[model samples]
Target: MSGDHFHVHGPHDHAVEHAGHGGDDFASQIAVMTAILATVGALFSYQGGATQNDAMLHKNQAAILKTEAANQWAYYQSKGNKQNMAELGAVLTSDEHRNKFEDDVARYKAEKEEIKKKAEALEEKVKAEDELSEASMHVHHRWAQAMTAIQIAISLAAITLLTRKKWLKYGAWGTAAFGAALAALAIAHI
Candidate 1:
């Protein structure tokens, strides 16, 4: 209470004020721990989001490659159909025209082989992209788990601050450690 000024002290503010006076070291320690956990949680959340985005990008690439592979397969099928038609023509045509039809059949067969090879290559690329997407998603999940643990630790810290419970403080520390472990796992991509 000061001239022309008013102040209100909430429970947290009172606790912090006491902490400044060396009255409640536990409160101050919890406050510091909460701040650190919040910072680490934010970083974990960012990493989770980044990994999710990477997964989506890789998935999209896989889809595009799959479509290209499908198109190649379709082209190969069309060539096969053309080859069948040429073979039919060679069997029904006169000797003079038979050789020309046979040549056309051989050309179609070669072209189909090339198209098949291209389609198989595209399929392989799709598989690779899909695997990349899955790996990114796994990392993202690990980050999310780490973030969840950190959030729980933060909540526990707040509760401990309010109740001055030693058990809750220990729980918060344990949860924070678990979160750090998960974050390490994410970093290692394991």
Candidate 2:
């Protein structure tokens, strides 16, 4: 045979050549759609992770604040006990020593008031941190939902590519739109 003999093309080669010539536009469209969806899904996943981390940090802060508040309450109780002891000492002591006990009682009472206020303020901070943690978790859940929808859309796009079905393409687009909407809600903190 001459060196210029005809060569036979395999099925795969023919399909590849056909795609390069834009003969299978549906496949190219599906390829582009899935690529975009995958990128968006990655962003959604990252946002979900970040939100979760924020929620955990806020929860930890709330717990720390609660412990501090408890300590302040314990200190306040100790001050109250000291005040009671001073009052009793004043009642039982002689006139010359009674004035010192009275002075101690007044100081302890004032210290207890200050400690009580500190404990209450810490409790309020704990409540605020708890609220923030809850809100972050809510946003995280929204991001997760968006990611799930995007994953479904990407799967649908793959199926459409395999089956060459127009309806599946439309369904994939619809699901991707829904995912985008959920991501918007997450951004809005809803």
TM-score of each: 0.89, 0.92
Judged by whole-model lDDT over C-alpha atoms, candidate 1 comes out at 0.95
Q: How many pairs in model 1 have backbone atoms within 3 A of each other, for residues 3 or more apart or on separate chains, i.e. clashes? A: 0
Report lDDT per candidate.
0.95, 0.97
Pairs clashing within candidate 2: none
Clashes of each: 0, 0
Which ten contiguous residues of candidate 1 have the minimum total lDDT?
16-25
lDDT of 2 by residue, 82-176 (tens): 99999999999999999999999999989998999999999999999999999999999999999999999999999999999999999999999
Q: What local lDDT score does residue 180 receive in model 1, on the 0 to 100 scale?
A: 95
Residue 11: error of model 1 in Å?
13
Instruction: Return the TM-score for candidate 1, rounded to 2 decimals.
Output: 0.89
TM-score of 2: 0.92
